[model samples]
Target chain A: MTISSRSGSPGPDAAEETTVIPVVPAQDGADETTTLPPIDVPVLEDEEFEPQADRDATFRPSRAGWAARSAVWLVLAWFVLAFPVNFLSPFTLGVSDVSAASEAAIFAIVGLSLNVLLGYAGQISLGHQAFVGIGAFTSAYVVVDLEMGFWFAVAVASGLGLVQAAILGAVSLRLTGLYFALVTLAFGNFAQQTVFAIPELTGGEGGKEAPRPAMFDSDYSYYFLCLGFLAVVLFLDWRLTRSKAGRALQALRENPRVASSYGINVKAYTLLAFAVSGLFAGLAGALMAHHDEVIVNQKFGFQLALLFVLMTVVGGLRSRSGVVIGSAFFALLHSGHLLSLLEPVTQTIFRFSLVDFITGTIGLPIEFVALVIGPILLLLTITMYPGGIGQQIAPIREWMLGRRFDRHAGKVTEVEVNDVRA
Target chain B: MNLPLYEQLALALTAGVLRGAVYALVALGIVLVFRGSGIFNFAQAEFGTTGLFAAYWALEIKGWGYPTSFLFGMGVAIALGLLTERLVIHPLRDSSRVTLLVGTAGVALAAIGFQFWWFNETLVMSMPKINEAFFMTPWGAVVTVQELITLGVLAVVAVGLALFFRSPSGLAIQAAQQEPVASELVGISVRRVSMLTWGIAAALGGLAGILAGPYLTFSAGFLSFGAVGALLPGFMAAVLAGMRSMPGAVAGGLLVGCIEQLSSLSILDGAVPGAGALVLFVFLLGVLLVRPQGIFVGKVATA
Candidate 1:
């Protein structure tokens, strides 16, 4: 018996999908017939062979599920927009708390800026504070000395950031891995000690004043401005990760030599990333300057750079929502607002205020709490949960997007970021 | 005490040499770890700080003898090295080098935090030098006995390392580092080699700390970011060594020290604030661009 290849789907007889018919050739010198299983050909119809992805794509959430997701979305939106403004929420945020919220938004922008370099380009900057500091100082200089408006100052700062970062990127492009990191560290030190030390520029020890925009003078309005900037940054970041340049960056990050072999201009694309990162950082720095109403050189220290790296890494690289959340969390913690927010809960649960426990019992100042606890969290994130908070909240994010809840949906089997080539 | 320009230059050179010895010690530890494992250990300087803090605790807090405290500090540094290797490094051995760098940095931060917490009462502390006397150089530079001791120890360490590499265990470490699979086939315990290298490197870092601790009043991150900052210089030296040659590291350390001191020349005094850092930054960029394999190093290192 011979098996024939069929062009169409098998009929009712296709129940036995795999029919192993053994045949013995008549020319065999064996007394017994040796069974040889023939290859079973799959008779699949062209129109019927749909992939699992297509099935998932065809899925539609029930009306009730859609209603639930929309409600949750509304709550989240209200929490972000109206809670602080005391519009629809019962709990009211104080003036200081609103200011802290603005800081959080700025931090989120900074985190995304770092994410572009570390997560996408696979370059680490230990002196990121330098970039941010330059931005702040630029904005302050423009506003104070040049008598520029808030918007013009921010624009100048961001442009300077792009120019400076591109220059630094060009210089360090020849180096990679730890060597590049060392250069950034040195540059940071240089900027801190030499550049920031100029009395005329940084306004000496007293620092420079950066007034808020006229319309956004109040803390509440300023917070909305920050949130609006954050939204713009988030949009830009989302666009970046989906573009051709972003693909090139991801390629080079995984393996620069391989990417170069494929005709990708590693240096050009890396410089683009640096410019973009710098632009965002400068914007953040300008916002930060107005937020504090007074920007000082002392604010941009080595510790702050490390904190930026920590929040970005802990927030999970390459995850937009996660970075925003992580940056906000750290900002709130740094402002001491997070502890106050959880004061009542800690009072009930642990029988003591958490801030008092950290300050009095643990003998650590409130200001240093993030520095101390952040590193431990960083270590845990890198070792055990490489995906970080983003991975943790992935299932819920997917569920809200009208997909079936998958516990392991966004689980990163291995860290997407790779080592810089020597 | 204002000397002529040439005399001042000579004095600066003399002082730089004395400071370079400590840098040499730190560079040695950095080079050792890099050669052992393909990692840029950010905690190398922090290891020194930890050791210094431990010695400080032993001496001032516990009222122990100087020699005993020094040894105890070395022990603690070695223990921290082993702990870091076992806890953070070993588990992520197969991960990318950047991850390992981050891990080491985390370890350093944690240690710094612990120091800040434990030694919060004393913001600054000083240790007595081995000898209290100072000797004036021909050019009028006053050299302390402690500086001479540091230089002497660095010479001994350099010679000792040269000899150690020819020994069986040292050779085993070299073999394991070069080719782990081949070394394993030859019945070498790669794990043990890694542990020994880390332990020795930590000890070297500890020695640098103990010797330099007396040079200035120390704070939490004494050798890292404090008054007697040596981490950047050490890293510069290691890069100058191409991250592989031990002898090159020693030579590189001295050269870096001299170059850094050149910023103190009269011409650069008011031209730039923090001119030393500017010089170092420029020098680093030049070296990286011109001879990335390092000035002292001849051959390319196997990555």
Candidate 2:
């Protein structure tokens, strides 16, 4: 019910700053802004008082508090980096788990790529598997046949991804809403059936090898390399979303007509979003090709497209941390490590192996766990927890940032993926 | 022996029409749901697949009579439609159309996953045709009695729907769809009408799956991505109908089918890989660009 004003970092557009949070409750209908304005003027004009008295009351952590927070932050960082390699850890993890961690990072990249389209631009692509698959095949062909290095293959793949997305962006201009989604779905099928079936490019059904980059051949080292790439992508995403282009995309997504009227080039920003999404997808695909050492056409099916959407939405659209965690969680589920990780907890609760219960009593295979449970989770997320894991963890993130842990700090009013009729 | 060009065209036309029958059925279902609830109903094709699996289980696994199994499949599909309307669609009715679309897609994925889980042991499965007899057309393309039955069913259903619209309950459905608030004031239960429309659409989809399943071996998402892949074509057909007109849907389905068959011509055989899918894609884009209002749908006056 409270409307919080933003502090620091004044944006170029003052109007945008005022309307950014449009968080006033719609049901109330009574405008509360006029009733209780925060008068910044001094209250006690007759009494002598220190000028900085109000500012001194603001919560700034003491030196010891800062040290404790830093220690906790370092532990969290170590858990992410060191846990995969079993360095100073209690649990035993084989190389396969480490490799799976690499896949998780790659999945996070794909999820972020989707967030650009679905979250930022409000464009849903049902054929993202095609986008990623083309990248995978392009990378593999460049590396294996042309004898190009990994970095060059990656560049080519990302470039090709941009080209393909531009082509689709043209179609998207003609079709919006469900019609555009249908086109993407058809494109995905076409890619799976025709493009990937080419014996020359994809090596037919057998697939083609994509060698790991030189000096990072070991699994542990490769894991670090994936993490480094993930960090770069994260940084790029952060910078992009904070730029004017990001603001333009948000404007277009809300109302293209109004945005265009305000001198924003809706078409250009939309294409930019598509280009960025495709680039990230391509980068992930190239990484995936080398991670598996071989890329096959079958891996980029419609199911994978659904999986990508699932991760992005369930991760909570537009929430970077949520998308990363959701994608990694699903990746772990796909790799069958999630069940094993939960085995001890389930055993303590249910007095039996939960993994065994799922595979034995339920007759669901480990690999199929994500497919079966993911949709259920997606349905629940959309219907009940619209903000998803990101919204749920907002308070903690605020607390970590040395702010008050207000439970409603990052609440999303409503997911605005509707009425995209053009 | 290579066929003459005329003969090849004849084969393509005949095959296209036969295949178009199934597309028409699927399109009818899509149009119905779109008209009734304004949902794209991504689960429309999955309903058929789920029904086909149910029928397969009853006939193959449970050793039920064919007629009984077919009815059971339709029953299961209708049940699923009602369940979907109650659980996912109704709750999301006030949400955005895209959210409803995503919800239906989620329903579809769940159904596909359940199919995979239930029928995992049987790696490949096929339903028996109603009649095993086949006759060769003048173009040398063989036609099965099963296909003839499919065509016959499409005709009957189309005519039946036309006549049903003249009936009282059908009028209620039409009224509710056009003006739900006014219809409610007039004592028509809008909720029941929605359930009825979804049930009928699901039945139509189930019919398509049961008929099309015999054309090839079936698996999870058969009508979606298998040899009989009808989801995209069905959507194309619905689009060609402007997602509203039933008769237009039938015509659109036939037109889309024939257009897709153009890829199978002898001249274009090896030149284009996945020619059928590619042809369909291009045809869809062209239709959307040139006549997005639909080739078959007549313009209606808006107030």
Which clashing pairs does model 1 show? none
What is the Å distance of residue A163 in model 1 from its true position? Answer: 1.2
- Give residue A316's error in model 1 in angstroms: 0.8
Runs off by more than 4 Å, candidate 1: A1-55, A416-419, B1-3, B298-303
TM-score of chain A of each: 0.87, 0.86
CA-lDDT, candidates in order: 0.83, 0.85
Residue A13 shift from truth in candidate 1, angstroms? 33
Model 2 regions more than 4 Å off: A1-57, A62-68, A344-351, B166-178, B301-303
Indicate the worst ten consecutive residues by lDDT in candidate 2 chain B: B294-303
> Which candidate achieves the best lDDT against the true structure?
2
lDDT of 2 by residue, A1-422 (tens): 11122222122353343343333343233455556554423323312233233332366777876887788788889878999999988888889989999999999999999999988888888999999999988998898899989889999999999889888887788788788888888899888888888788888788888888877798899999889989998999999888989888877877788888989988888889999999999988888999999888899988899889888888988889889999999999988987887898788888889888898999998878898999899888888777777888777776677755567756765555455762
Model 2, position A163, has a per-residue lDDT of: 85
lDDT of 1 by residue, A1-422 (tens): 11221112232333233232222232342445456433323323322433443445556789998999999999999988998788887776788988988899999999999999888888888888989899999898899889989999999988988898899899778888778888888888788888888878888799988888889999999999999999999999888877888788888888888888989999999999999999999999899998899888888877788789889888988888888999999898877888887887789888988878888988987766776888889888888988778888888887898887668766774454454756
- Per-prediction DockQ comes to 0.61, 0.66
Residue A197 accuracy (lDDT) in model 2 = 80
